[model samples]
Target: MTIESSRAEISRFRSAAVAGTLTFDPDAARRCADLYEEQAEHLAQLRQALENASETEGFGGFVSAQQLQAGFAHKARDAAELLDRYIEAAYRMKEAFLLSAGLYDEADAAAAAALRAVDTRVRG
Candidate 1:
């Protein structure tokens, strides 16, 4: 893909984030976790595809096999690195959802404790 295409995808994701379309609430944390796993697998596959592939068309005087392999490695590295950042963002969002859930639980417990105290005092 060209640089413009890459930028467009990045812009799309950023816009989604701005729209809260990527929201990961506590109830959907499980789904987000699954997505993170899938993304990890996808990235691994991309890396493996490049790492395991043999040189191509280096037979042409235009480029050597080593240069072609290096080019492939460079592209793979860039793709993998970009994907890793996105996956990490997803992971962070999942963690945020989990943390928010925990905070809610703590707040609920606190409210219950306060209610119990009020009840006890009022009944005495």
Candidate 2:
């Protein structure tokens, strides 16, 4: 998903969670985690490509070539850094989804146990 769509989804989740109305789906969470991981991998590949391009031989003695090379190097570095940040963010999102799934599972188990205890007392 695009960044805008992710942001919108996150906002919706935050609102629902705060209101105690969020519905947790383990399968959906797993799928989201997988997508984020895929995104991170793609970003990593792009970053590697950028790194390779940045290492290209510098220009010869010509003044314009030298200036252009310097500018390109600077911009390339900035782009690589931005891609690195995006990769990190994507991994973090993947982790968050996985954690949410585990937490939801735990919460459901706890609630079930609590209900079982109540039912035993009522039926005893």
Which candidate ranks first by lDDT, i.e. highest? 2
lDDT (C-alpha) at residue 117 in model 2:
31
For every candidate structure, what is the RMSD over all alpha carbons to the true structure, in angstroms? Answer: 17.7, 15.4
lDDT of 2 by residue, 1-124 (tens): 8656764665565455435565447788678877877887798788778878877675888999888888887777778766765665565555455445555553344334334433533542
Model 2 CA lDDT for position 62: 95
In angstroms, give how far residue 123 of model 2 lies from its true place.
64
Poorest 10 consecutive residues by lDDT, candidate 2: 109-118
- Candidate 1 lDDT over residue span 71-94, tens digit each: 876776565555444444444333
Count clashing residue pairs per candidate: 0, 0
Candidate 1 accuracy as lDDT: 0.49
How does each model score on TM-score? 0.44, 0.62
